[model samples]
Target: MTFSLVGHCAETGQLGIAICSSSIAVGARCPWLQPGVGAVSTQNITLPALGPQVLEHMACGLSPTQALDSALTRNGYSQFRQLAAIDYRGRTAHFSGSETLGCHHTLPGELCVGAGNLLAGASVIEALVRTFETSGGQLADRLLAGMQAAVAAGGEAGPVHSAALVVVGELTWPIIDLRVDWADEDPVGKLAQLWAAYRPQMQDYIVRALDPTQAPSYGVPGDE
Candidate 1:
């Protein structure tokens, strides 16, 4: 059983996703991002290979929906797939196949959207969709809030296991990519807290990458 939300922030101007599941190590099955390209999440009877292939199609100028359609068409077992994609420009596309596990649904929104599978109930998806659209903030903040709403609405029926969040910019290698492969409990909360903690570090890293050799002037005695 699992409930996941994979989406990109339009104004954050980055591609990213937040995911969780009752399944052991769900991170291993979903979430993929490449800077300057696109983002993909292949799950729910997943055809994992499609994730990368979708990016290739998008790179060739195909829109999000067109890329998804072509990728699914090429898959031998398209009916069993639950996948979503978002391009660099914020266009979104998703497919929830007929053979999806149970109570599976995906909502496509303007700035963001989400897909859920093996859900505890229909409420999970509903809450996520509402949160994504109603939440006010930049893209990343909205995505995070939507995910927390889904978890609060009762996440996957199975025990909390693994969780992950990935974000990338036009040139940023990885602004945020944190994973809790297997947590005893509250993987989503842990992921949120982890993200909060890592944000500053990542920002610092970005700063360093952009212009290193500048040190913070804290407690420095008068230099000669």
Candidate 2:
């Protein structure tokens, strides 16, 4: 019931994940990323702990594939889990277990991995990877584009109600983290609108957190 992609931007050394699902609050469970470490998406039956475990393994110097393998081996029901990881160096790996629900596919690319279960078909994942590879702009933008492309190519077997986009740069906190917990309409598009509004002020928000005295004003009415 979920489709997700984990990606790295070689130019900026940023890592990110974009995901959508028919399930409620998919973002809070599926996507994980640590600055300078890696990005992981654990879906299918959705083992939330495995996402962080994979990140920790990568932080301990394991490659994406090695980390995924280690995580899978430790799980008793590995057959129900779908996993994907992309390391700091942009090496990518993915696994869709044999028992994943409905149709599923994982497309591992040079700097990204796209995976999905209970999807429209292989074309969903295909469009995700292809769009991510060809689209330009920030890493977050490309990730969103990939998500949009998946929907265009026929997204989840059912309508997707929740979506998320997360990107981390060189900070302790994510550079971009947006989610639509549940929406009757297009959650991905709602996320895109949030990104558009957030893009110009993202740096300002960080600056405020790091040094408020030097931060810009509210840019609102009557503040002076």
Candidate 3:
């Protein structure tokens, strides 16, 4: 019921994940990332705890494959989960459990891993990897492009009701975290709109958090 991609921007040291699913609030459950660690997506039977556990392993200096392998070994229901991870160095790994629903696939790219369960076909994962590889822009833009390509390639087995994009840079908090938890129409498109509106002010908000006197005003009520 979900399709997701986890990636790293070697040029900027950024880690991010983008996901969409037929289920509601996929964002809250499927994606996880730490600024200097790694990114993970846990879908299918969706053991949400596995996401942070994988990140913790990567943070402890384990390679993405090693972290994923260790995490799966501890899970008795590993066969029912679909997982993907990318370490801080852009090393990637992915697993699609034998019990995953519908036509599922996983593709590991140069600095990313794409995974899906209950998907349209292998082409969806392929499109995600191709878009992320060829698309030129910020890490957030590339991640969004990958999600767009996934939808263009037919997306999940059913209409995706929720979508999310999360990117982490130097900040402890996510630099970009946007979601359409549930939408009758296209949640990915809705999330894209939110990104467009937030991108320009992203640094400004960070500045406000770090030093309000140096922060730029966007003519908001308190600016005067």
Candidate 4:
């Protein structure tokens, strides 16, 4: 069973996504990104390798639909694929293959989409989308809210095992990539909590990565 969130942060100019599954370690295999190009979520019958290629297609100037089409077309088992893409400009597109694991569905909005397969109920994707729009915050907040939205709507057919979120810039490895490789239950909530606790540190890490030679001359006490 699978549940995933793909969205872009207009404020930060970052594109990101979070995914969780009944199967273990979906994050490691499902989410991928290119700093200034875009982000991709390759789920359902997951193909971890295709994740970056989707971004590559887009970076080559493919539209969301074209990029998705090309990526799926290349796969022999395209019928079972599920994908979400957000381009550098934040134009979004999503598709749930007709042959997705089981009873799969998708909900797409202006700049985001929620997709699932083998879920407990049909309304799950819609609930994810609705909550995402209602959350009203930064892109990461909305993305987390959307993941919570899916969980509140019943999530996977079984307990969740893994979750991940990745926000990237054009050259950044991952701006805010959080992975809960496995959790006992309520993986999404756990993920959000982790994000809150690590957000400041994550910010510092990115700043340091961008300009490692420059040290913080002063701040709060020993932090300097």
Candidate 5:
């Protein structure tokens, strides 16, 4: 009951994933990213540890295909999982095991890969990759657009309750990580709204973390 896309932005050297699921808190479990390494999404039965494991493999110089193969090989339940990864070089890979849920598919594109299980149809994944590859602007914007397009085309087999968008740049920490853990309706839309609100302050937050004295004021109470 999950659909996800992992992408790399060549212009800015950013990597990220956008995901939606019928389950609660999909963000807390699925997406994994290392600033200069890559992005990975582990869903469909969701072995959360596999996200990190795959990233570790990528960090050690494996291609997305090899990293996924190495990681899944070590797992006892590989056949129950669905995964996608994109490396810093924009190379992509994906896998949908034999036991994936209804209407699963994977679409690999220039700088992104979309994969899902228990989806409405293969069109959902196609929409994800197509929109991501064609859209313009920041990595976060393309990711959000891809997700919205997928929902517009046809989402999961049922209503999705959780959505997450994560983007990592040069820092060890993510530049953008937004989630709507559980929403009765339109979780992806809610996630997009969060990204909109966070966008203007995203770089400021990074500066604050690195050097607070040079950072802008909070504009609240005592800071004024």
Candidate 6:
């Protein structure tokens, strides 16, 4: 009951993932990324470890396809899992197990990969890749736009309760990691709103982490 996209921004060398699902807290278990490495999404049967496992392989100089293949080979339950990856080089790869839910498919695009299970149709995946390619601005915005287009095209077979957007640059942690872990309605829209509010402060937060003295004031009580 999940739809996801893994993308790489060639201009900025950023990696990101956007995902939504009928299931709760899809973010907590699906997206995985390492700065300068890659982005990975592991869903369907959902072996959360596969995200990091695949990334480890990518960090070791394997391509997205080779990394995913190496990781899946170690799991006896691969037949039920769905996974996708995009390396720093923008090469993409994906696997859809034979048992994926309802109408499921994986579509690879330039510097991106879209995958879904229990979706309305293959058009969902198509819209995801197409929108990402055509969208503009930051990597995070493109990812969110791709997700919004996928939903408009026909999202999951049922309502989506949770959504997430994650992006990583040249840091050890994600620059954008916003999630609507559980919402009664329009979780993707809620996630987009969160990103809107966070975008202006994203750089400030990084500055705070890297150099407190150079960081701006919090604009709260004591800081003011």
lDDT of 6 by residue, 1-224 (tens): 99999999999999999999999999999999999999999999899999999999999999999998999999768889999899999999999989888899999999999999999999999999999999999999999999999999989989999999999999998999999999999999999999999999999999999999998998899895
Q: Estimated TM-score per prediction?
A: 0.88, 0.97, 0.97, 0.90, 0.98, 0.98
Q: Stretches of candidate 2 above 4 Å error?
A: 219-224
Error of 2 at 185 (Å): 1.9
Q: After superposition, how far is residue 32 of candidate 6 from its true place, in Å?
A: 0.5
Clashing pairs in 4: 35-169, 35-170, 36-170
Candidate 3 per-residue lDDT over residues 116-184, each given as its tens digit: 988888899999999999999999899889999989999987888999999999889998889999999
Per-residue lDDT tens digits for candidate 4, residues 8-90, read: 76667778888888877787898888877887888888877677778888999998779888888887678778888788787
* Candidate 1 local lDDT, 1-224, one digit each (tens): 55556566655567877788776667677887777678888888766688888999999999989998998898778888888788888788888878888777788777565888877778887788789788876555667788889888877666778888888886647777788888889888888889778865666677767776663433458932
**Deviation from truth (RMSD, Å), model 6:** 0.8
lDDT scores of the candidates, listed in order: 0.77, 0.93, 0.91, 0.80, 0.94, 0.95
TM-score between model 4 and native: 0.90
Off-target runs (Cα >4 Å) in candidate 4 are 213-224
Worst lDDT 10-window in candidate 5 = 215-224
Model 2 CA lDDT for position 163: 95
lDDT of 2: 0.93
- lDDT minimum window of 10 residues, candidate 3: 215-224
* Candidate 3 segments whose C-alpha is farther than 4 A from its true place: none
1 or 5, greater by lDDT: 5
Ranking by lDDT: 6, 5, 2, 3, 4, 1
